[model samples]
Target: MQVKLIFSALTMATLLGACQKAPEPVVTTDAWSPLAQRYVSLVLALGEHDKSYVDAYYGPAEWAEQAKTAGQSAADIATAGSALQAEIRALSATDTMLRLRQHYLITQLTALISHAQTLATGKRASFEQQAQQLYDTLPPQRELASFDTILAELEALVPGEGDLTERVVAYRAGFVIPQDKQQQVFERAIAECQARTLSRIDLPQQERFTLEFVEDKPWSGYNWYQGAAYSLIQINIERPIDISRAVDLGCHEGYPGHHTYNALLEQKLKNELQWVEFSVYPLFSPQSLIAEGTANYGISMAFPGEQKMQFERDVLYPLAGLDAALAAEYAQFLKLMAQLSYAGNEIARLYLNGEIDAATAQSLRQRYLLQSEAEAKQGIRFVDTYGAYVINYNWGKDLVKNYIEQGGSEDERWQRFISLLSTPKLPSSIAWE
Candidate 1:
């Protein structure tokens, strides 16, 4: 049985009303443009200190070169970012859009300064603290005992096991997409997602992406957004890929996910509104919460209810030479597994906070997340490298889902979802309640 998630009517009304209200008239000249340019420059400068800071930049080549040549230290970058933040604060904007731009700048600069300070001092904050300061939202803390109900349910679903994790893993092993069939299945899934997205949202005809399979990554998939509405999407094939991942990664990394989100932002915010800040994506900012949350939610938006399972059963199963009969059961199993997604965040919090050791965290992940030894090791690597970013995938998705599905028809939800993707909205701006 499929369960539909919905927010309360009151929450829906509040968000919808917020979206409907008109902006105040512009009382001041455009002071934000200069600040926006400086914001981009500061991000590039900080990127020199931290290689992973600037996730994507499609802005001017000279700016990047200048940033590199200037060779600003993390401390120097933090000072400059503070100065920029002060200037931005001194400005006033009565218009709604201008206010949003102002808020976005302030939040992003705060994250920049915090990141730079951490780099300079080599002192990282606690997982929760870092998640709040860096991503502008705190992931909910969940107890390991809280997941026992879900585990019991999964037990009923997959009985007869030496270990529940081993049973689940063994059952799932049959559904792995073969290496030869991976490309075709993924291409087909991406095409369907693209077509569905095009039906509702207006994107640039020139918007496109190149997909590649690669190895040796902490994360499963990545979208390197190039300027001009293009992205280089890569999938890590070091571990076996289950058939369900075709649509999941397709919607997540490609169409109406990272690719579409970047394209719309490029076309609407950067090119149309002439907002320079949107041209550069800083990985450890509030913007990432929105980017990741929306991308994860995009999978369900593109294929609601049983539609995803049906697509896989009818189309992808044959393409991958998978057993179509197991599609529904596998889909159900995956849904149950998703109930345990937040386990990663909890594990990260414990391990990063020194409450648990690496070995303990790995064991917890295998038990809760039902990950194989290799997968659990990779997950720990992700935590070791990215720290609290593990929260973005699940927590971000929940926030996005709550905001977009407050109360609406499928079409109405798409409209709101597109509006979210094509704006400067941040995690702080979302009405979580």
Candidate 2:
């Protein structure tokens, strides 16, 4: 029997979990922002089984309340689920980057539906049996991989596995990246951040803020949150960035970037009803459009009215220890990897959606990502199950660039930029015409 194989290079990206919820406040805090409460509720429901992760991200009291509501009114579940979907759809539809995310949201919805449907039937064993059947049919490359394993890994990092209140306390305590190494990284990041700050909105250093990185933790590169805290940012030094990536990513991740923009908004926008939602970010909310877009455009926004080629040639390349030729080659390689990731994601999504054969999926991964035969085989299984999310990194970057360029620039435009981001529940399609 000629068995078909789906190459697995694309699948490797699928395993990289993304985003995280912010830690909730301890005191009442004015009933909390409705958007924040909404996300807190959803995380509590979807992540209830893993108290540690929920508590670590959402906090103790809020997680407890959310847990109570999870089994409450079906209307509440429907409301939460619909709101999430609506928010995501609005954000994604505004740009191609977000539009790609529509696919991801749908996949999550599908899984939630399957789970809910099983529960509605009131046949516990039957639900398990059906899930098992679904698992059984996954490609050999995907065999034996269970959600439990994924949850287990996540649980280890999050604190407070049981007791919502305890989980919340643990979440707050654990929300911070470690403290010992935080100052060192923060200092370096600050120095690095200043170089790019000229184009940023003017804010005092103290108000601008810095999050000290502490113990080694698994996180994406640093992220910024505008809240009661000023520019709440997290960084994992383990992910070393060469200079080119640093300049662009630094601008994107830090000053004149996400951190700068977020901090400015927190300070400038205090109209209780206006900027409150922006202060407390919701991952799938329209606020995400502002958060992700400027962060993505930080480099371009800072360097606008300047020569990008010059910066690449004079600043970034030399810092990375590469000559012109070598830099060009490395740049090309990175671009190719991004393209391959995009292509692999398309193939994976098609396969998972039942549009392609397993072998075809494998070929796509191998041909595009240049994966080892075995890895390629496994990747197919991964992508088939996960669908098109790998596009977010580069594709999102492109969309953000497009949106910013479309917006005309004025003097110290970064200030205006911060204002836009602070707008309450602004949709991704929000343009500055």
Candidate 3:
């Protein structure tokens, strides 16, 4: 009986051992790893040359320190970028995600090299050429006359107009949030946006931001993404604080906009997957297209159709001490204005290409964008500073909207949108169809 028991125990042990799988081999070498490290270092080095080159960096401290002291010229940086591109292209990735990483590196390196060469040579391509090279997509050209129909529609909405621009401005002036109540209104708007976004997306518990109202800035709002899932958002009070902008800025700069986008990339790609290339964001690369596009589209995503108007009417209007009855009219006006968004891009194209002077550009902005003189000048200042970057907002929004809405339920749409945020997708890579 003892011998039989011993044999059974031996048989059981053998069967258990056979069922256990072998220990998986540790992946010690990834061909893309070194190239990714080099890319991060190169991006840091480029930041040394152009103050605006590096938008955000949260990589190794030593790498940044090394870049500051490298003393490489633009030509040298371009050469290095080209070499990196060659190395990246020489390697092929079979895995789906790995292939995406490889393509991302290749396209980004191409933009980096092109920008470096431009800096070194002191010569620039045409506005269209530069847009294509820098942003990886060209904004559709629209004739200025194409906006006349929208302007006429706005004219009927705000009748008895001396000029359509003046009438529209006079109408919207009633919707400005009082200076004293600006902070309160903005806080409420941001909180609502946060709640909506949090319900749909899972973000790091520690991720957060601080808000400040700033003056003398060209742009209306800006998000400065700090590493570690934090951001500093500044709203330019230099212009009138429109009640609509509370939700616009709330969603655009905070919830599902720049702040959320940066946090996800840091959390998912940089921290989780250890993709070092995401550590530094270059301002001029194709990534901005995705960033700005999604940020603008986020306003609509967070509040679809009449949802935004309802929120502003019921919640924000009372908070700002404005008449809520006119909310529907303002909503219609804004929708019409959105149709004319492409006009800004056309005006910028004309101005940058020297087809029109600054004065002409400002005039077109007033006539088309229906801006006050101060606002028109501010718009021109933005165009002067950002150049082809004007296209990123409207064009990028259209691209992202189409991609997210392509055959999905609302839940699936949110999932697709979040997927775009977490992945390394370029403008050219997004499926328009």
The TM-score measured for candidate 3 stands at 0.92
Clashing pairs in 1: none
For model 3, what is the alpha-carbon lDDT of residue 317? 95
Clashes of 2: 17
Model 1, runs deviating above 4 Å: 1-29
| Leading candidate by lDDT | 1
lDDT of 1 by residue, 1-433 (tens): 1112122122343434433322112212467777888899999999998888899997777789999999889999899999999999888878777778888999999999999999999988799878988899988888988999999999999857679989988888899999888887878888899888888888775566667888888888898887676677888888899999999998998778998998898888887777888889999999888889999999989898899999999999999998999999999998999999998899999999999999999999999998898899999999888889888899999989989997578878897899789988888876622
TM-score-sorted candidate list, best first: 1, 3, 2
Model 3: lowest-lDDT 10 consecutive positions? 1-10
Error of 3 at 262 (Å): 0.8
RMSD for each model, in Å, please?
A: 8.9, 16.5, 13.3
Using lDDT as the measure, what is the rank order of every candidate, best first? 1, 3, 2
Q: Write down the lDDT of every candidate, Cα atoms only.
A: 0.85, 0.43, 0.84
Report the C-alpha lDDT of model 3 over 59-102, residue by residue, as the tens digit. 77778999999998989989999998999999978876777788
Superior by TM-score: candidate 1 or candidate 2: 1
Clashing pairs in 3: none
User: Which stretches in model 2 have alpha-carbon errors above 4 Å?
Assistant: 1-76, 79-190, 203-226, 230-242, 264-276, 284-286, 305-341, 351-366, 369-395, 409-416, 425-428
Worst 10 residues of 2 by lDDT: 1-10
